[model samples]
Target: MTPLDSSWLAARPLPQPDGDIDKNSRGRVLVAGGSETVPAALRLTGEAAFRAGAGKVQLATVERAALALGLTMPEAATFPLPANDAGELGAAAGSVLAGYLDRCDTLVLGPGMGAEAAATAILSAVIGEPRKGLSLVIDAAALGACADMPNAVRAHEGRVVLTPHPGEMAQLMQRDKSRPEDDPEALACEAAERFGATVLLKGAQTWIACPNQPVLRFAGGGPGLATGGSGDVLAGIIGGLLSRGTPPRTAAAWGVWLHGEAGRRCAEQIGQLGFLGRELLPHIPRLMASQR
Candidate 1:
């Protein structure tokens, strides 16, 4: 396949600032993921959502992480799920989650959720159901959870966006191969067509592809973003955009752009080596404001 060209970049338009009174019209976003090992994922995603313009951000996590997240970011609401002896979300947690799915405009799954069986079950339930009005963004562990559940993506009634690194894409494609560093765009487009959803394949040049839309490459982000938790931050931004009534392709395209811009801003200040995901939080609003 020929490498995806750069022409798709011009297709997306920057978001216009809402009138002062209409600013509150921004949507609600729910971030579900967090386990004993990686409790910070939920907080990272929730904060990023708020920064990206979600009017409200809620997080669903295991009991232990809930207290810390709630205390740390009092702006975000928390829903604690029942965990088994292993400290993982149990299958019953899905029933609890289903009740809140209706309240959120978008659902962002699998930030820091570990690979425990109970967590897998909860993710499976969330993806299996038909979420009619909600948009879903599957990232990190959630992408891995769906490796054998390609049909789950097909069955979902809502808009779905998948953000994965090359390794994760390999697993999703069920292929034991490495990403052709030469053409990340082509690989992402193939995966998006196969999965029937918008695909954001992350790398030096993040590439986004949707079933009907042309492949888009965002070349703005820098190496500063290669750190951990950055992907969760990107996922949260996408969730926020989806909540704001942006189409899946538009949200993915803009989210990737904003994320890279944020990383670039951070690199300018922190010299690229020590910039943390949390640091990128403050830059989101500035970046969005610049779009105007």
Candidate 2:
């Protein structure tokens, strides 16, 4: 496994804006559904996207969470879609989402979403139908939806990136709990090839793999990254970079490194164990700015 470090960043530097460009010209990101109860997950993601250089950020969530998110994050435009009694996004919202698909450069699916039956239907509809110019970052409860069909995300055909922890990865592969594919490098590569999407298997040491490319390993987040919702931030950061027009593989790799750096910095400031996932938000652009 190769380390993702400054040398790697130097070798494959991030893209820089050329000339006069408006915020719209830079990038626009759409975050689709997290749990109605904890829209913070999706909110964290959209904020991270903005920090990662996305010019515009939008959120499409359930009715209740929709209003809260709009009030909390004024920078993003929020849409409230139909929700079930359990407060999860419903299948009926698919048509509403289709109308916004063309407007975003990248889509972040499944953050705080609880694995409700409706979630699977929504995921199936969205992931089953891939968009030509859109990039997808699939994480959290959405991974459960992927578990139902081994090849459903394959429809994305290299345009999607799946960020899953070990448990979720097992579900995606339908592997036994023993986790025969627990080795980050092998699991990341295998998932990428089998699902036809870039894979970032999150762990103490994260690994990213894309088809036909060597595995990229990043090893430096402290225990701080162990906190809940961190994966949401990671997904958002990666999605944001993708929205900025970074290629899938590059965006995943860069996102992993930037995420780790942000975690380490946050840990250093607040002590290793007490930092919140939202704490990582403020450090993201600072880390990304230094990298660029």
Candidate 3:
């Protein structure tokens, strides 16, 4: 396993900023996941995408929460999608989102999405269609959706990244979640090969695996990053990097480092465990810049 640290990150440089470029040049990120129960999930993801230097970020969520989510985040362009009485997105969401996919450089799927039929439907609609320029960051409920659609995920090949915790990873790999993972890196690699995509298996020590490549590991960030919405931030960071046209494996690796370091910094500033996920955002750009 390769160590995912500052030295490794420095060697794999990110796209440098161009003074003459506009927002469109940096890249656009579309975050499509949210419900009434977890409406603010999109805010954390979208804002983190922006913090990671994505020029533009948009939020597509259930109709009920769109207006208020928009009010909280004026930076994102919001789209209200059809949803059920419980505020989960409806099947039509994926179809509606298809219209917006081409406009975004990357799509961050499934954050704060609760268990619902819409999750599978949306995943099917999005993966069923081919959007060449659009990369995917699959997380949360969408990770579960991926299990039922492995071939669909493989259809995207190298353009997709899966961000799942051990429980979610177990689901994707069809492992018994009740049992402990014997080897996290091995499991991550198996999932990566199975799905034909980069897999970041999140834990206290994160592991990133890509098909036919060396696995990378990061054991920093401490318990502070174990909080809610933390994975959403990491997913957004990866999505933002993918928007900048970084390769799936490279983006996943860099994002893990940035996220861990940001968590470390937040722990230093706001105590090790109480720091909010949003608190990790401001440190991203600075971390990237420091890598330069």
How many steric overlaps are in each model, in order? 0, 1, 0
Which pairs clash in the backbone of model 2? 35-113
In order of appearance, the predictions have TM-scores of: 0.90, 0.95, 0.97
Q: What TM-score does model 1 achieve against the real structure?
A: 0.90
lDDT of each: 0.79, 0.83, 0.90
What is candidate 3's lDDT per residue for 1-292, written digit by digit as tens? 9999888888889887778998988999999999988998999999989988899999999989999999999999999989986789988888998888888999999998988738888988888975788899999988888897888898886799999898898888878994326789888888888889999999888999999999999999899889999998999999999999888899999999999999999988889889999999999999988988
Order of all candidates by TM-score, from best down to worst?
3, 2, 1
Give the runs in model 1 whose Cα sits over 4 Å from its true position: 1-25, 117-119, 180-183
Q: Residue pairs in steric clash, candidate 1?
A: none
Better model by lDDT, 1 or 3? 3
How many clashing pairs in candidate 2? 1
What are the clashing pairs of model 3? none
Cα-lDDT of candidate 1: 0.79
- Worst lDDT window (10 residues) for model 2? 176-185
CA error at residue 228 for candidate 2, angstroms: 2.0
